[model samples]
Target chain A: MALLEVMNVGIAFGGLQAVSQLDIKLEKGHLYGLIGPNGAGKTTVFNLLTGVYRPTEGDIILDEKNITGKSPAKINQAGIARTFQNIRLFGEMSVLDNVKIGLHNQIKYSAFTGIFRLPGFKEKEQEMDYKALKLLKIFDLDTVAQSPASSLPYGKQRKLEIARALATNPKLLLLDEPAAGMNPSESEELMNTIKFVQKEFDVAILLIEHDMNFVMGICEHIYVLEYGRIIAQGNGESIRNNPRVIAAYLGGD
Target chain B: MNAIKNLKPSTCNNLINYGMVLVFYIVVQILVNAGVLNNSMQGMLVPICTYVVLAVSLNLTVGILGELSLGHAGFMSVGAFSGAIFWMISGSQMSPVVGFTLAIMIGGIFAGIFGALIGIPVLRLRGDYLAIVTLAFGEIIKNLLNAIYVGWDSNGFHFSMKDVSALGLDESGEVIVNGAIGITGMPKASTFTAGTILVIITLFVILNLITSRAGRAIMSIRDNRIAAEATGINITKYKLMAFIISASFAGMAGVLYALNFSTLAAKKFDYNTSILVLVFVVLGGIGNIRGSIIAATVLYVLPELLRELQDYRMLIYAVVLIAMMIFNQSPQVLAWRSNFVSKISRSGIAARFIKQKRQSEEV
Candidate 1:
């Protein structure tokens, strides 16, 4: 059975159908891409999948457990984590602290332990610090770990968001426009990093990216979306040649 | 060696603060007991302590945790009435220490339960709507308190305030509170020493909580709810935790206020008190614990300090608040202050000594 299955998911806002009868399935370690032009409902789909917006009608099954309309925190606790299209690091906090927050669910210390400084609390805190440092090192952000997240350059902020999501130890990861503001070289680097994350973390990835080169280079399978509908789903080369995909991107018959 | 050197300044500051608070309280209490200070001055101290505790604790919710709640006064009212009633019934039978302890605990518990109830409904509403709902809830509580009637024992359980006061003291010799007229005769259980101790304890707990992981979770929710949620932090649960804790502290402060004054008035825990506390939090650095405590003390004492101006006291306060808002909000004012300080230090010969010391330490 697939690790995640979305069946006939539909969501609407007022009269606008933001997403309509969308379906997706992913195996444990697949590198999948959801691509489309602006307002193609790619992010809307991400929002639906991550439980940020509940589908008006449909079922989202993860590991044989149905998780429809669960709170976003519940979805994350169930081992699905995501980054925003616009980097949403806790800007006032230090870079390492932002990543540390992602580890919140895993920590075993109670509020009582936290306030009174219990022995187990100290050990758990040390463990969290070590884990946060490890994740920071993976993103090559250890040097600026103590600096406030807002003070980081835009590229580094994006990297920090990814590192923070990874710190949650999610079984499935979703990246929304991960290369939204990157130059070619930076986009190239990010493409390799995404692939590396998929391989090293042994986690399935569902990403929405408009950067064609980055999407085309790293994605094993690509789904093209237009006007809240999936127009085509196939390997990258097939997507590149599809007439509908071409029409969607070029706006022609 | 490097870690110790780095930690030295903060550690020294902490020690100095503790010593100063201890010395100040000791001297103040001695002066008060010696009758050098008037009853009005003593009365002013109660409000100052209560406001300081309320402002500092409310900062946990508003400034650091970043949720706007105006129902804080409601929680304070709950605590005050509950604690005052407890003291009235059992205070004369028990030692002052035990009575004070019971009062604070009752106040905290009452406030905490009400806080959780109010938070469950309102915490789901974020930003402006949340503030409005909480403010409405506070008004509702005030109206509810005004309407509720607990019959007086005398004259076959009379409903009127006149009849309630006629019920006379319990065996404890304290007058039972008459509904909206408030707790008439509470024991003057809180001393300056007790208030000072409570302040110290509160500062310790708040400081420790804010610097801890749970505190950081609360702060992260304030900073970015979506990011915090994606990280598996239950935003509502943490926000409620902040709310309950903030309310509990405010409640404790209310109990302290009642005990200090030997009376409780419903009008005292009105909307204006909540706004006053908010001003204290804002005028001080919002998230800074020390700043809140300092702001509460300064603002509470400012009115009294200008009491010689009599009727103009309130006018002066309004002017000062407006001026402060204008100056604090302007970036140019901050820049000018920084520039002026820099210029002064640069012109002083002591600046060279300090710069040399800093360089030596860096090396």
Candidate 2:
């Protein structure tokens, strides 16, 4: 069974269809790439899978459980965690605290225990601190753990976002343009980190990237979208040779 | 001193806030014992403590939760009335300590209920829409309380919205609440010591909460609702939790405020009161608990302390307000303040003291 299965999912906004007839099957512990032109509904697909938007048609199943139309939090609980294209980090909080927020559901303590500083609260908090630091250490962000999320440089912020997502302990991790604003070297470094995360965390990764070299270098399989529809799906070499993929990017002659 | 300095940043921060309150309490006690405080000065103490608690709780909603609530006073009114009614009903039956504690709890619980009710509907609305709705809710509460009339006798409580005659209470029935007149002849149970203790308790709960799992969740929502939701944080749950906790504290403060005066009026908990608390939160620096305590105390005392200046007092107060705003909000001022604080902590008297202590420890 696939780790994530999107069975003919589609979402329409009134007269316009944002995403239509989208189908994806992600196997466990694999790195997949999603590429598309601007406004090809790549983020819309992410939103649908994460339950930020309920699909107008079709179902989404994660780990063999049908999770379509569930709330974002519930979808996350069902093991689908995603990073935003725009890097929606908790800016004012500490880098360590941001990861701890991801561990919110992982450890349980009531507001009552918190206010009174009960024994369980202290014990759970220490465990959370340890867990959060370990996750931060993975991204080499432990040194700046006390620094605010916004204060970190752009590349570090992206890494922090990924670390935060991984803290949720998901089966399928979605990355929306993980290398959007990075230089080549930075993107290369991010590519390595993403690969490490895939192997180390042992979670399937479905990433949307525009950098062809980065995608071709890391992804085992790639899907090309144009006009909210998958134009082609194949290995990197096959995708590169496909004339339709060329037409969508370089325009047809 | 070294031990305090070596503590975690959050723990050190908590100690500073708690210590500041304790020191202030002790100094005031000394002044009172020395007969340095006038009757008017003494009278202002409990109210100052009340406003401090109000400011801290409001900061939880406005600062930590990142929501502008214009109906904080509405919750306070609910608590004040509910707690006052409890005291009236249980009159002289319980000891003061137990009765007062129960009244505070009752006040907090009632206010918390109102907070949850308002939060469920209004929380769905954001920004100015939320503010406007909360403002309307505050006005509604005040108006509703104005029309309510309640009295009690051996047969139980009688209630009416019309005239007092419509209540149809027996001749022995005593009116606890008389429409716009509100609660009258209520015993004064609030003292400065009690007020200070309540302030300490408020700080403990709020500070502890900020470092807790739930507090992190609430703060994450405040920072980025989209990210928080993506991380599986139950948005509504954390939002309502912050709102209710804030309301409950405000309620307890309200009960303390009401019990200090024999005659308590619903109009006392008006929009102006809510705005007054908001001013303290804003001036204190949002999400800065220590700043809230100082701002609340200083701002509340400034006008009274300047009373001898006559007409110039208002002018001075306005200037002080502007000064505080700049001090709190201006980028240049903030940078300078941080620099100044770092300098003091690193190389000033605090540094020298730590150095001396370290040298002695080595010996």
Candidate 3:
């Protein structure tokens, strides 16, 4: 069974279909990519899958469980984590705290246990500290562990966003424009990080990127969207040769 | 070992904060013990501690939860009246200490329930909307309490609306809450020691909550609501947790306030009262718990210190507040603080203390 399946999911706003008939399926540990030009609703599709906007039409199944219309937090608890097109690190917090919060669902202790510093709370803290640092280490952010998140450079902030999401221990990870603001070399580094995350954490990955080379390079299968619809779906080799994909990208301009 | 090294910075900050609270509490106690603080000055103790609790709790909601709440006074009034009523009925039967303690607890629980009720819908409204809703709630509760009449007679407990005549009691009715008169004949069970203990408990619980998983979830919501949700934090759960917990502490403070006085008035908790607490939080440096304690104590004590200069006291307070706001936000002050901490840490005294602490704990 697929790890996640969005069957005919669609959302509309003021009579405009922002995302429609978005059928997506991800097997365990697979790397899938969603690419579309400006105004093609790639981020909207990510929002739909991650529960930012509930689809007006069909179902979202995670691990064969129907998760349609669940709250964003519930979707995350069901093993789907996502980053944003805009980096959303907890600005005033330490880098480590940014990731520990991502582990909110996993920590097993009550407010009473925390206030009293019960044995379970401390054990959970040590466990969470271990897990958070491990993810930070992978993203090369362990050096600035105590620094405020807002102090990080743009590339580091983007990487930290992904690291924080990884701390959530998701079965599937969604990256919305993770490579948006990076320089060529930075995007290259992000690609390596994405590949490392896919293999190291063994989580299926889905990313929305405008960078053609970056998406095509790392993605096993790519879906091209146009005007809230998936225009084509194939491996990079097939997509590069598809006429419809070319027409959508060009808009026949 | 590497993990321990990584943990050093945040742990040191906590140590400094804990040390500050202990030192402040002890210094005042010593001054009182030495008779350096006069009767009037000593009287400021309970109020100072009460305000400290109030400021810290409000900071949790306004700073940590990143929402403006103007109905804190409403929650406090709920706690104050509820706890006052409990003590008045029970104080005669039990030890004063037990009665007072129970009063605060019951008040906290009641306030927490109100917090949940108001927070469930109010917190869903972002920013200014939350503030306006809470403001309305504060006024509504105050008016409701003013119009409430609780009395007792040989027949049993009697409650009436608007006036005592509605109760149809004979001349034997013991009026507890009269219209606009509020609760009268409140026993002076709120003492300085009790206030101090509550302050410590408030700090311990609130500061610990900040470091816990739940606290981080609340702060994350404050920092980035969307990212907090994306990371699987149930925003509503954490928001209400912070709001209710904060309200409960404020309620405990209200119980202390009622105990410190002879009578209680619903009007004591009004728009101005909420604003005063908010000023303490802002002056204390929003999210800083230690800062709240210091700010509340210093600000509360300032007017007392200038009591001799009664005419000019208000002017001095206004000036000090303006100066504090400027100094608190100054880049130079922030830089100096970082510099001072780093210098002290490099001396290894902090590290040595940590080592000794670790050894003692292991033992």
Candidate 4:
């Protein structure tokens, strides 16, 4: 069984169907790419999966559990975590603190314990600091851990978001335009980070990217989306040769 | 031990806040002992403490929680009445320490309950809508308290809203709360020491919560609600928690303020009082805890000190408010201030002065 199975999921906003009949199966530890044109409902799909919007129809099962229509927080706790397309970071927080926020549910202490600064609270916080620092170190963000999230360069901010997402210990990770606004070199580095994250974290990765080179270079299987529907689904070789994929990107004559 | 070493910066910062409060307490003690403080100055101490507590607690909502609450005075009013009522009923029966402690706790708990009640619905609304609803809630609380009349008699506690006569109290009964007039003849158990102690406690709870997991969650929501939610944080739980904690502390401040006076009026905790606390928060630099403490103390005490200014006092206050606003917020001023601070630190002026003092002492 796949780690994630979006079985015929669809969402409509009144007169408009934002996304429809989206079926994708991602096995554990595999890297998948979701490629599409502008306004092709890529982010809307992510929002539906993360329960930002309850699907008007269909079930989203993660690790054999049906998690459709659950709140974003609950969906995350159910082992699916996602980064936003527009880099929605906790900008005012320190980079280290941002990742620690990701570890919020994994380690728990009561509010009373926190306010009182009990021994248990101290121990838990130390543990969290250790864990958060370890995660930051992986992305080479440990040096600037004390710096505010917004102060980091754009490329590093994107990396920090991914690191924050991975801190949730999810069974599946979704990256929405993770390479957006990055130069070619930064995109190349991001591709390596995504590949590393899949291998080390052992979570299935589903990412949406507009950069064809970045997508084809890293993704084992790719899904091409246009007009809120998948135009093609296959490995990079098959996806590149498919006439429909070419026409969607280059525009039909 | 190594983990502790790693925690030095934040721990040291917290220590500095506590130390500053302790130093202030000691200096004030010295001044009072030396007879340097006047009668009026001494009298202003407890009120200053009360405002300090109010400012800090309100910061937890307005600054850290990232919500504008115009009903903080409402919570304070609830606490004051509830605490005063408890004291009137049981204070004479117990030791002063025990009675005062219980009174404030009752006040805080009552206010916290009200916070939970108001926060549940009010928190669903964000930004300006939240502010307006909170303002309305504050007015509602004040008006409701004004109409309430409660007395204790052989028939136990009696409550009536129409008037005191409708309470049907026995001849032996004494009114604890009279409509409009509010609570009177209450014990003035609040002292400067108690007020300072409450300030310290407020600082402890708030500062500790800020660095904790719960604090992180609350701050994340403030920084970015969507990101926080995506990170598996229960937005409502943390938001409500911060709001209640803030309300509870505001209530405690009210209790402290009420006990210091012989008479307590619900009207005192009006919208203006809420705005005054907010002014402290804003001028202090929102989300800056130490700044709030300093701002509250200086701003609250400034008017008292300026009594001699007479006609010029109000004009002077407006100027000072603008000055503080620019000093705290203006981009050019902020850059200059940061540069000044960095230059001072890099020049090692304080460090050199400390070294010289140590050498002279050793000699």
Model 1 agreement with the true structure over B255-328: per-residue lDDT tens digits: 88888776677777778878888888887767757667777887888888899999999999988777766555
Q: How displaced is residue A189 in candidate 1, in Å?
A: 2.3
Candidate 1 Cα misplacement greater than 4 A, ranges: B1-39, B147-175, B309-363
Task: Write one digit per residue (lDDT tens) for candidate 2, span A1-253.
Answer: 8888999999999988988999999999999999989999999999999999999999998888999999999999889899988889999998888998999889988889998988898678777788888888888888888888999998899899999999999999999989989999999988999999899999999999999999999999999999999999999999999999999998996
After TM-score superposition, what is the CA distance of residue B288 in candidate 1 from its true location, in Å? 2.0
lDDT of 3 by residue, A62-155 (tens): 9999989989999999999999888899999989999898887777688889888988887899888888888889988888878899999998
The clash numbers for all candidates, in the given order, read 0, 0, 0, 0
Return the TM-score for each candidate structure.
Answer: 0.87, 0.96, 0.95, 0.96
Model 2 TM-score?
0.96
Rank order by DockQ, top first? 3, 4, 2, 1
Each model's DockQ score: 0.53, 0.65, 0.79, 0.73
Better of 1 and 2 by TM-score: 2
RMSD of each: 4.8, 2.7, 2.0, 3.3
| Local accuracy of candidate 2 as per-residue lDDT tens digits, B100-209 | 88998999999999999989999998889999999999999988988899999889999999978888888788899999999998889999999999999999999999
User: What TM-score does model 3 achieve against the real structure?
Assistant: 0.95
Q: What is residue A227's positional error in candidate 4, in angstroms?
A: 0.9
Better of 2 and 3 by TM-score: 2
How well is each residue in A81-164 modelled by candidate 4, as lDDT tens digits?
A: 999888889998889899999999888999899988777987898788889888888888988888789999988999999999
